[model samples]
Target chain A: MPYAIEVTDVKKTFSGKQEVRALDGVSFNVEEGTVFGLLGPNGSGKTTAVRILTTILNADSGSALVLGHDVAKQADLVRSLIGLAGQYAAVDENLTGRENLTMVGRLNHLPKSYVAGRAKELLEQFDLADSGNRTLKTYSGGMRRRLDLAAALVARPTVLFLDEPTTGLDPQSRNDMWEVIESLVGEGTTVLLTTQYLEEADRLANTLSVLDHGRVIAEGTPAQLKSDLGATVLEVGLHDNDDVARTASVLNAIGPHAPNISGRVVEVTVDNGPVDAMEALRSLDQAGITPTTFTLREPSLDDAFLALTGHRTEDGDGEDGSAAKGSGGAGDRAGQPESATVPVGGNR
Target chain B: MTTTISIPTVTGAPLATGVGARVRWAISDTLTVTKRNLIAITRIPEALFFSTVQPIMFVLLFRYVFGGAIHPGHGINYVNYLMPGIFVQTVAFGAIQTSIGLAEDLQKGLIERFRALPMARSAVLAGRTTADLCRNVMVVIVMTGVGFLVGYRPTTGVLPYLAGTGLILLFAYALSWGFALIGLSAPNSETAQVMSFPLLFPLTFASSAFVPLADMPSWLRGFATYQPVSVVVTACRSLMLGGPTSHWVVQAVAWTVGLLIVLPPFAVWRYRTRT
Candidate 1:
């Protein structure tokens, strides 16, 4: 299939007293009708990349094309083909929900006769029909977001760019947005979503690109990325510091990978975490090493991110990825404030 | 959700193709957005109330309190002499709201929202200036009624009276573009309001909007004489009070045209360059 959107080594730098490189040679392509997820944290160029692709911003070098039209040279054509819901809700506060949607419809060149009707249809679809006549200031945050998304869909765009659409939404609202997006794609709209939440990307994105410091560091399906990191992690904690080396050797021999240690804790990634945990404990038992804790865990997207970027998913700072780096014992202590000996990575 | 209506499942937006059709669509887009803005003005009772009342306040304050002391002399009634200056000044101050509204839109992402649509990009600016123009027209009417109530009369008849009002609106419309640029440049509402006052203070005060050119210091009078607001006020006075209208009309029209030529392109350029 021909690519619906193609970005080729796009570079964008914001020049000022401090020349911040907002995008550094980033590239990706979205297949005609698939969801492409761009995952990154704050200051990681996700917004910059979306701006360039949506033609809200221009890249300093390289090329970006939407539906075969160059974004820089043919911006009008690109604008006609796509819809964008920005990080913030972009509806006019002074206009009523229906008025805002109708105004956007007319702005997009929809027939004057059809605009009001179309606005009504979209409002009902978003479950905002009852509040259609109310001004946006009176709407709750979720209703405003829903209305903003509805406004973007007025033209029935072929490709949609949602830049962190659910960032600040409550759980139910986020799920509603997710379902709306899923329905859009189900009806043949290609979507490119940028997000900081790992669960959002895991649940919604068909393919994922992990970005750090304005560049793509990793790209694959969520399962593929997690599998490449390893199947699961086996965690062990010894009661005494003296038994740490023995526990590490036993775990290192049991798992297919080397054990990573901090203080009296040890952890290793293996193909089967439960089996590996049982083997390591048996070996340690024969070696006369008593561990205070042992457990297995199903690897999460956080684990994939941690393994690939060498940073915990919670630590947004890429330059200091190790700021919140914790050992198996640290994870145990952190997980339960009430007790220190509870097994970390508690899978079963 | 109820599906009692025909929901547009999947389709492309209709483009305004062909040269004539596109030009017509552009005008339509401008008018639609303008109507939206005008509706906002009516809905916000405080905005409408303050806008109408401030000019009334100015007429009363200057008419009752400051009229006798600042007369232009030569047997003209103080109220008649003060009406044109007050009316023109109302439009100028009324134009400031354009910048505040535009800046608020920019801060709230409405400008970015407009940028993404397929409409003619110039329509945003056109709609904004036109809505503000309509608001100024209403202000002119309200203040003129207030002017009549306070015993200000123009012997110059209806033609020039309408012309004087039209000229004030024209100048205010062009000046709106300048404020549009300021609005685009201002990052927030507070800055948008305070930042514009410094630029406007000199334009309105230094010009003969509320006083005569002859009452100024000689050095200040040079600018107070030929500045756009002064030229416009002079044109207005010539039209309504019946004097030599030729030279002032020429300069006033020239100033309005010059502003029209310069500010819109610059404002649109600034709008385009935003990231």
Candidate 2:
């Protein structure tokens, strides 16, 4: 099947006193009806790529095709085929939720009667029917985010571009958004989602791309990328700090080379986590380096991100933290790895 | 041999769309957006009060306080004379609301939402301009009512009165376009207000909205006489008060058309550049 979205050698540069290359020769394809995630850190050009694809910001160079129309030359056609829930709550605060949705429907060239019906359906679907008459300013952050999403879907666009849709919502709201996104894809709406959250990509995306510094460093199915890295990580922490190095050396002996130590924690990647854990424990006992705690589990998307970016996903001089905060907790929600407590490195 | 039934399927031809259809689409979208703006005016009554009521109050204050001190040889009542000037002044003052609304919309990310939509890129400015024109009409109505109450009568027939009103509306719409441009280009709402200051004083004071241009010093009179607002207000006054209206009417229409042609594209350009 033809791709729903195709971007070829896209490059965008913001020129001023200080020139910034927002996107540099970025290229990717999102299959039709698939949930595609563009994952990146703050200032990683994910939003820029999304913006260019959405026809809001023209790419300085490159060809982007959405629904068989060129984005730069046929922007209006591209816009009509796609719906975008921008990074910010771009809904009009002065207007009621129903009005916002209806406005979008009308903009999509739906007849007045159809617009009314679509707005009603969307309001009900998004669970905003109860407060549809209330202005957006009175709604909570989560409600606003949901309404923004609903507004984007008012036209029932074939290709939906959600740029950090659930950024600042509480966990419950994020889960609700996730469910909505899942259902959207189930109904055959191709989604191009950009987010800083790793789990979001893992859970929602059929295919995911890890971007850093305006380049896609990794792209695959979540399972494929995780398994490609080879071995699940088993994280072992000792109650005593002095035993960390000893524990690492013990695990290193068992794995022959994969154990790494950070402070009181020792991490080792193993093909068979449970069997390796048993052998490593036996070795630690002989060495008298008893670890207070150890757990083995599958590698997380964060681990994948770290492996690709060569740094902790959250360590970026507060820039990423602020960007995440600015986007409203969507990044942090996705940042929370589901297998968080899994011991690092027993699976080979 | 089995006979097969073959159904000929007919696909529809592409619709014969034109620029008119696109413009209509843009206008409809603009109206939809402006519906909320109109509702917002009611929610924030202060905007209406300031834009409409305060200007009328200023007219009353100026007429009673400063009217008798200044005179022209036409033997016209100060209030009657000031009505035309006040009409222009009120409409010009009312143009400030366009900037304020634009700034607020920009600050709130409303324009960004419109930008992402498939509607005409010019629809946002069009909607704003249309909405402000509606507000201008409302203000004009109230001003006219007050003028009637204060014994200011237009001796002309209904057609000329309507023509005079149309001229002011056109002039105000054009003037508001310039303000909208400033609002769209400003980095923030506060800065927009600051940026509009240079246009504000010169456009209002240099016009024949208050004192006659002939009463001013020679150099100042020359400038004021040629200012667009002066031409428009003089045209309005001539039509309403039964004076030679031809020269001023032509000048006023020309100025209105010229500004309308120039400013909207500039506003759209600024909007595109900023976004």
Candidate 3:
């Protein structure tokens, strides 16, 4: 299959009060007509990668090509072939939804005669027909996101770059966004999606690259990553918080990998489901650490993410990391305003 | 909103090459953005209202409050002198909208979106300054009506009055380019506003926009008389009130030409290197 996008050894560093190596020799290839997910914690250089591919920021070294056009040397050609929807909606709040779409269509250099009809069709497709004439200030967050996505589709771009597209969306809106992406893929458009949610990657991405500290640590299908992790996760919920370390030490012998802890719960991915479960319980009892709860379940991408990155995808305290929303997630910082500057690296 | 959206034909043709297509694309993109900004003004009419209202207040303030306090040696009415000054002042202040608008777009990530598009890079700044110029035209018209209400009459006929209006707008357009640089350099809309005012207050007040230059202190006279704002105001005064058209108009045109030559390329460079 021909590649829709190729990024090779792309590196970019932003120098200021402190230097941030936003993309440290990142390389990835996205096949035509497939969703390629870049999964990483916030500030791990996902936005930097997208900015490079979209031709918004030039890499310090290395090269990127979109649809065979060099992003650096032939940026205009690359820009004409790809569309980007950033972490923020990026649509004009003062203009009506219809006007914003038409504006983008014109900027994309679509035929003047074709733009109005195209904007109308996109508004209907995005279910924004009713509020198309109303200014975007009145639209809900979900509606604005839909319009933003629609605006990106104005010229029917062959490749679309979505940088944390569903980062702040509620569950229903996220699902709707996923459906829109799925439908676009069904029409044979290539997509490069950057997201923090493992489930979003699992559901949409045909292949995923897990990034950490501005490097791709693992790349595979969701099932491949999960299966490579282990067969089951031995989760031991300890009643006493102090006993957690002891439990991890006790369960450490069962799995080849080290035990992972969150609060009082200790989890380890084990190859043998029943044997490890039995071994974990007996070892805990012998150590005089009474388990508050215990369960041995199939490993999920969430477990795989934790195992590979050595940190949970969502805020560590959340019960289910996948369900957690917003910029309050583990490495996501809220105080600084988002700017054209490389996403800051202060989260570390 | 139209209820029924037709199934539109999709086209993904390659971009045309050569100079003509490029220029056409830039012009088309500029007009599109200008239309978007104009629509925004319509949605928030209060923005337009406040922009004009400030000039109107200045008209009332200088005419009623400060007019009686100062006398012109040339036997010109205070309202007549103040009207041309107000015209220059209003357009000069109106140019700040270019700065604030671009900064607001930058803050909201809209500028990033524009950068990613296939269109001409100059269109964003060109569109902004053009839209602000259009707004300045409206403000000039409204101020003219207000001037008439206060008994200010132009001694020149229709063509010269139009020429004076054109010169004021040309100066404003040139100033808008300078503000465009500030907008692109600023981190946000609020910063753009804060940064622009220090530059504006000094130019507008230090020039001959209000009182005559002779009444000012000797040290301030040279700077006040020759500054671009003062020259443009003097040019407008000559064109509207029947005076020697050559000297002041020539200087004002030269100042506009000089700014047009210097500021645009710098603003474009700022826009290009923003990332």
Candidate 4:
């Protein structure tokens, strides 16, 4: 398959009171008709990279191509083929959902004859037809997001850029968003997804690049990244944040690798999943340190993410970190990376 | 709200990619975007309400309250003199909204959505100034209606009055581009408003908008008379009252053209390079 988007050694440094190298020689390729995930914890330059690829933010050096057109030189050509749903919905709160989507079509110079029909069709597809006439402020978070996604499809763009599509959504909404994204992929639209959630990337992306400090730490298919992590995860969930360190020490006795504590859970990479999990829990039970829940699952992108960022997948947020969703199976790990700003948030 | 959408029978052919096609797209795209801004004004009733109310309030307060005390000349009819100046000032005041609107769009990341599209980069600015022009026209008409209610009459014929309205709109349109730079440069909507006020406040107050420049101190008179705001006010006053009409009209036109020439590139440059 042909590549729809490609970036080579892209660099963008923002100057303020201090200089922030938002992207330092970042490179990636998104094949056509496939979802490519740019995974990062926070401020990892994923959003910046998406901005550059979308031609909203120019790179300090290096070139980006969308559908074979150079982003900086042939920006209009690239823009015509791609649609962007930003970190924020970017819809006018005063305008109704139908108006918002139609405006996007108008901006693209889509035929006035077909634009309104397309907006309605998209609203219906996104399950927002009944609410299409309501102002965005009146819509729920999920409804607004559905409208934003619908607006991006106003012109039926060949390539789509979705930046953290499910950041603030509840699980049901997030799953609905995932289903919507999956359906779009079925229609052969290439997607460049930037997200902080490991499960979101695993569930939707065909391949993903893990970014840290403005560089790609690793890149592979979901299974490849997990297997490449080369470890089995012992996830121990406890009652509260206070129980993390105590649980970590208990898991350390059975696992060969150091236990990584993110908020309330202690994750350890062990030699054998079945034998080590039982031994660790037994030790914990004897010590009277009963885990609220424990599961032995295959390594997930979260473990790889932790390995790359060198921080617990705790999202660095003190409040919701303890409540991070638990991923019981190897296929899906529930960790939503909070919206992280680069130590210096710039160009956004 | 649920009207049936017309099925498009005309799915037009793709035009050949050339300079002519690009130019055509620019025009159509700009009008489309302008339509969006104009439609938004209707939906946000408060924005329209406040925009019209401020100028009417100024007309009422100045006509009834300040009219007896402020004299332009013995027979000049302070309401007539004041109405033209008010029209000019109101149009200029319209620039602040341009900046505030653009600033809000940028702050909310709406401009990024615009920039990401294949549309002309200049469309956003063009649509905004065009919308402001439309708004200034309505405000001027409402203000003129209010002027009549308060006994302000223009002695000039229909042609001169039309010319006066055109000049004020042109000047306001140019001023909107200048304010657009302030809007694009501002970090947020509140900052955009605060930043524009200090700059525009002096232009309106220190000029011949509300009172005669002759009453001002000599030190302030030079700026009050020579400034663009003053020149437009002077041109508009002459057009409305059939007063001396030597170079003020030409000078006002020149000032507007000068603003148009200088400010657009700066605003476009800022929009293109803001990141």
Against the true structure, whose TM-score is highest? Answer: 3
**lDDT (Cα) of model 4:** 0.80
Model 3 chain B scores worst on lDDT over the 10 consecutive residues at: B1-10
lDDT against the true structure, each candidate:
0.80, 0.77, 0.84, 0.80
Sort by DockQ, best first: what order?
Answer: 3, 1, 4, 2
CA displacement after TM-score superposition, residue B84 of candidate 3 (Å): 0.8
User: Best candidate per lDDT, number?
Assistant: 3
Q: How close is candidate 2 to the true structure, as a TM-score?
A: 0.83
Give the TM-score comparing model 4 with the true structure, all chains together: 0.87
Two-chain complex of model 2, DockQ on C-alpha atoms against the true structure: 0.28
RMSD of each: 8.1, 7.0, 6.7, 7.6
lDDT of 1 at A345: 24
**Native-to-model Cα distance after best TM-score fit, residue A98 in candidate 4, in Å:** 2.4
**lDDT tens per residue, model 1, A1-348:** 999989999897776444567667888889999999998776667877887887877899999999999998988778778898976789988889999988988887777678888898999999999999999889998898999999999888999999889988999999999999899889889999999877788788898788765678788786666667677887788788888887888877874667778787887778876677778778988999877888787665556555665555544243111111110111111342221111112322
Candidate 3 lDDT tens digits, A231-342: 7888899889899899999989886879989899999889888988888888888988899899998765467656665555453522111111112222333353222212
Give the runs in model 4 whose Cα sits over 4 Å from its true position. A229-232, A235-250, A261-267, A271-274, A284-302, A313-348, B1-16
State the lDDT of candidate 3 residue by residue for B1-275, as single tens digits. Answer: 22321232443424756677777788998998889888888888999999999999999999999889978769898899889999999998888899999999987889889988988888999988888888888899999999999999999999999999999999999999999999998877999999999988878989888899989999999999999999999999999998898899999999999999999999988888777
In model 3, state the lDDT of residue A105: 88
DockQ for the candidates, in order = 0.39, 0.28, 0.43, 0.38
- List A-chain TM-scores for all predictions: 0.81, 0.84, 0.83, 0.80
Q: Is candidate 2 or candidate 4 better by TM-score?
A: 4
TM-score for chain B of all predictions: 0.93, 0.90, 0.95, 0.92
Interface RMSD of each: 4.8, 6.3, 4.1, 5.5
